[model samples]
Target: MPADSQPASREKPSPAAAPAAPGAGLSAVQRALRKLGLVRDIDFALYLPMRYEDETRVVRLSDVRDGEMAQIEVAVTSNEVVFRPRRQLIVTVDDGSDTCQLRFFNFYPSQQKQLAVGARVRVRGEVRGGFLGRTMMHPTVKAAGTELPEALTPVYSTIAGLAQPALRREVRSGLARARLDETLPAASDWQPAWDLRRSLNFLHYPAPDVAMATLEDHSHPAWQRIKAEELLAQQLSQMQARNERAAQRAPVLAREAGKESLAEQLLAVLPFALTGAQRRVGEEIGRDLAREVPMHRLLQGDVGSGKTVVAALAAALCIDAGHQCALMAPTEILASQHFGKLVDWLDPLLRSRGLRVAWLTGSQKKKERDEMSAAVESGEAALVIGTHAVISEKVRFKKLALAIIDEQHRFGVAQRLALRGKADAGLEPHLLMMSATPIPRTLAMSYYADLDVSTLDELPPGRTPVVTKLVADHRRDEVVERIQAQLQQGRQVYWVCPLIEESEAVDLRNATTTRDELADALGEAVGVGLLHSRMPTAEKQSVMAEFSAGRLHVLVSTTVIEVGVDVPNASLMVIEHAERFGLSQLHQLRGRVGRGAAASACVLLYSANEGGRVGEAARARLRAMAETSDGFEIARRDLEIRGPGEFLGARQSGAPLLRFADLATDTHLLDWARELAPRMLAEHPQLAQRHIDRWLGTRAEYLKA
Candidate 1:
């Protein structure tokens, strides 16, 4: 059932921010159900069981085996409250063959009365063997003479105040009332053995004779149908978003013939030539901008791949067409880096044409912000670059044609839409989003299906490969000696800590303490600076400036410097508790160095727990970092480790779009969906729209931006 098909009284809230239903005289259970995003019959119909309970038969107590889940029928012989370790209620039950003890650490008065001595009851739980014979820590008790269920009982995931029985009743009612009409045409080639209605019915209450293993691992035919439908819905929604955008109008930024375009001029003035990959992607973007429709292209490359130069070229092209371009970065440090690089590359060229570059940030003083806003509004600033402040309501654009977002995954859906909404009325600006964290192929096909992707697969010439090494925490002294060696050679170093200050929750190194320690270790002659998120904006800028100017020998900071801070003189990176960081983050931090021709190295200093070893997942991340420097490979391994939700970060607004189909293991199904979606939309437009509405509803908005 589509959300739009529900009654008009229901409110649609995102899963993460699910609030109480907007109505009078609602029960606590109803409110709790709303928190789970179950406001519609379809929401309940799609909320499948996490697991099932076997209530089809009862086994004798003598036949119950240890380490196995079983239901046994017995009479309660004794019940008492005991307090040895703690207060508990213990009931001893016996059949003709054997006796078992049922313990409950917490019990209510109703439960006590129901389990009175000599009462017959049927209990279900995991059987465990102990000194007192067979026992169940907490068994579910029920009347003994009731008829067994024909099918397995579903155990749904629910919030407090909504018990499993209550939820089961609601799910059954919703399933009966939901509209399960066939959305796919009968002639579809991708049809599964089970239809949509049959799949949901079988999944919600499976037959007792079915293979539990297949159901648990989601390998059954019913599960396959569900995953296929989900994948198809996602594909349809993304295709719809793309088709709708094609109908909108945007500025045609094609270059004029017989005139040297701004991009060509910038290319001529660049100190370094563009790599083959850069030129290829640049051409791809150039073609998109030339079209009448808005360009929604993603530019992805590894760190040190010279993405900044490509972005500068794109900006130049936009400016050459007599339109404004805005570049937005997530953090101030990264935004400042882009600001400095763009100013150096285009400031003189823009000034020659009576145009200038403007910078804006949240930390800017009132007068500075006002000046930047005025320049932007007056169209004097042909190229604007800043942090989130660039999207502020006060900063209006004049003829905004293109918007470039760096590290786009760090931004939320609302933020990206806000930037895109800054364009003039009746027109949208072409979007060119750049990311240093290369997106894997599967991820690109699914999450980014709506946009064209351009990949800079190769780094620029003369980039040194950084050697990665893993060291235990006990070897901190040796890492210090290595840093000293770099300093001795007139090179700089970056010591990155996970935490900014002392934290009682985490027992890891802090930036402040590390800075002090390194300052004392290297003596007062060496200039050591500390940088973190909590520091004042001016202080962070000053510290980075000093480091870039070679006045600071070492810079100790947090992951704030992980992405875009560049210093050619820096040759070494030491990450404290590297096990605490993600694979992409570690790769980005290592990329901070190795920009210049100097040979660089990254040291991953990690600590072990009381068991004398790091966690398995953490070990995998460290091992992957040491084995490969390829951003694509790291992203692949990262997807395998963290799944797509964490890999995409805030891109999905904290809710993973695909709940059934997995991009990694279900590639075949995903390919089928991708192939069928376009055809369905073209041949059976009504069915495609209904399918998207039924599966996505309000959640489809996340993909549009």
Candidate 2:
């Protein structure tokens, strides 16, 4: 229920509880808050404030100087209130002729007490205008004789269900309980020996005038120290986990039915020609399957570059080996779409061989899911297409030989490991991690070091080229007319709107409000629809159905449509604010329309001079999109701009974890880290004995993010 909706009586005791109160009875939460590096930076970061001001001074009206901004106590003189029907509420108070009138816009009646007849009170405000009838409108106020401070106050961020003021009080109390000096281990044994006890003391309470100066001395460095510790700890934990997984992975690939023979049989049934890249990737998988050990391979290809085809080959190999295989996707839409394509493409081939496939997902009826699970368990289902639901305990594989993970980056290591964990002992399925985003080799090696990587950099033949152009929003009329003309020609188009929605569940706006506007211009006759994450899963699938089925001439959407939806009928992609997307994302969006053979074109609408802080990277991305359809090149350029964190989704796992390492500049350092990581783990995997382990242990927990 989001917790915040509960009544106060039902509220859990906040971190501000009494134990955190200063005079020595500190609790663990208080200590953690004191040690917390920042004010709610994340679930991990400890961003405690460096210092604070005591907002506890009371001032007299006679002492309030003219033309100064300050908090002062004042007595209310007889009031002459003005109620402007056409304007706002105005109330005045006289502090001996240099009176100030408070101006409030749309004020309610309860606010009248601020200037209650003959009441003396304290107020804080900027003195606007001087002499007779000076003013302070809706400035922060309190009751009479309330103490206020002239020092800048410390504001903090609160976690959900936490209040700002209460949090501040609690933090202050938590600091008291930490007994910073006692909590800090003596620095006698550490390098760069820091007397953290002193640092903590200053953080909690400082000498009068130099409090700010005292904090500035060590606060920033402490923050850096804490962040480094967090990073190291995460690295160590993952390294240890990886070590355990290596030993834990059972032997499934040794069977005679592993992949080679199955791959051959699977390949024999393809109706269309395989691209050279696809063939090469197939050969690699076939070779891996021939090995006695389980195959841990990663297939990285750009959007629409046929990663699924490669995955299908692996699955087919397992099927031929007399075992079942499971394919997992991150989203239901992507899963369903991929599953539909697979069933349509491979069912005919499998039908002749007397085999069948099954599907499972979260939204499926329990009864149907159970039926599929039973079929899979009995070896009646050769291939299972589904989301994470496939890894559930209820669904067991009778002879699970291989696991193909699509959009592998979206799944965590724990999740990736869970799929194989579902298989029986010594029958661990060959693991295949597939990604639509192109990761540079340096980043890939560090992040996916545990697995073998195969890249498909080539596009299939007969694919239409996307002509890219940059145009200002001022040419909307012309762009709208072009869209109308294209719609009239019976061609489908995708109008991609950059992120205008924030809800992760429905974060992609596609073009909600904009779609309404376009609908008005395009008229109700043309089949136009909006597709975004916010719509019910069924609704989104329905929209994709109408568009792919030629019912909708134009489908406006967000990046949600960038992956795995193939409509050979879509001939145009108009990306609004193309400058808003990353290079890889832009390339993916561009790839959407060119799938059809109708000679597709991508119109990149951007703001060149409307001046909203557009950068050279955006222009570079747009130019590159116009220059070539090569995704790898775009990825390389994108890496240069935003780094591999976004593309590889490895920032959290140190995918591109380098301060001194750059995919572009320090390519060698990155390569070195990648090479060293696996080897290091292979040697002293537990790392429980080394100084490196010591440093890493402290840092790894925070890295779980």
Instruction: Put down candidate 2 lDDT per residue, 1-705, tens digits, no spaces.
Output: 322222212112234343545576755444454343322212111234534544455444456565655666667765545655545666666555356677777566666766677777667776766555468767665676544444445555545455556566665654444322211112212222243344333434444355465345443444333333333333345555455444544434433633345456556766667899999998898777766566777798977788988888877766766677889988787888878878876777676767778898877877988899888888788899999898887888887778888877678656766787777776556778788777766555444444568999888777777788777777878888888888877788888887743444443433677788788899889877898766787788888888888988888887788777888888888889888888877887887877866877888888765565567888788787888777777777777778656666632453324332234544433433343444444543333223232233234432222
For candidate 1, write residues 1-705 as lDDT tens digits: 553243323223322223346554557777788778777677778899999999999988788778999998899999999998899999999977898899999999999998999899999999999887888989999999999999999999888899988888878877787777778766677679898899999999999999999998888999999999999998899999999999998999977788788887798888988899999999999998889899999999999898899999999989999999999999999999999999988999999999999999999999999999999999999999999999999999988999999999888999989999988999999999999889999999888899999999998889999999999999999999999999999999999988634572243335677889999999998999888887799999999999999999999988889999999999999999999888999999999999888999999999999999999999999999999999999999999999888898887793337888878789999999999999988977777777876777778877888
Instruction: Report lDDT (Cα) of residue 238, candidate 2.
Output: 51
Task: Name the candidate that leads on lDDT.
Answer: 1
Worst 10 residues of 2 by lDDT: 179-188
Off by over 4 Å in 1: 1-25, 500-509, 654-656
Enumerate residue pairs that collide in model 1: none
After best superposition, candidate 2 residue 277: deviation in angstroms? Answer: 1.8
Error of 2 at 237 (Å): 7.4
RMSD of 1: 3.2
List the candidate 2 regions with Cα displacement exceeding 4 Å: 1-246, 249-262, 351-354, 499-510, 523-525, 607-628, 643-647, 650-665, 671-692, 698-705
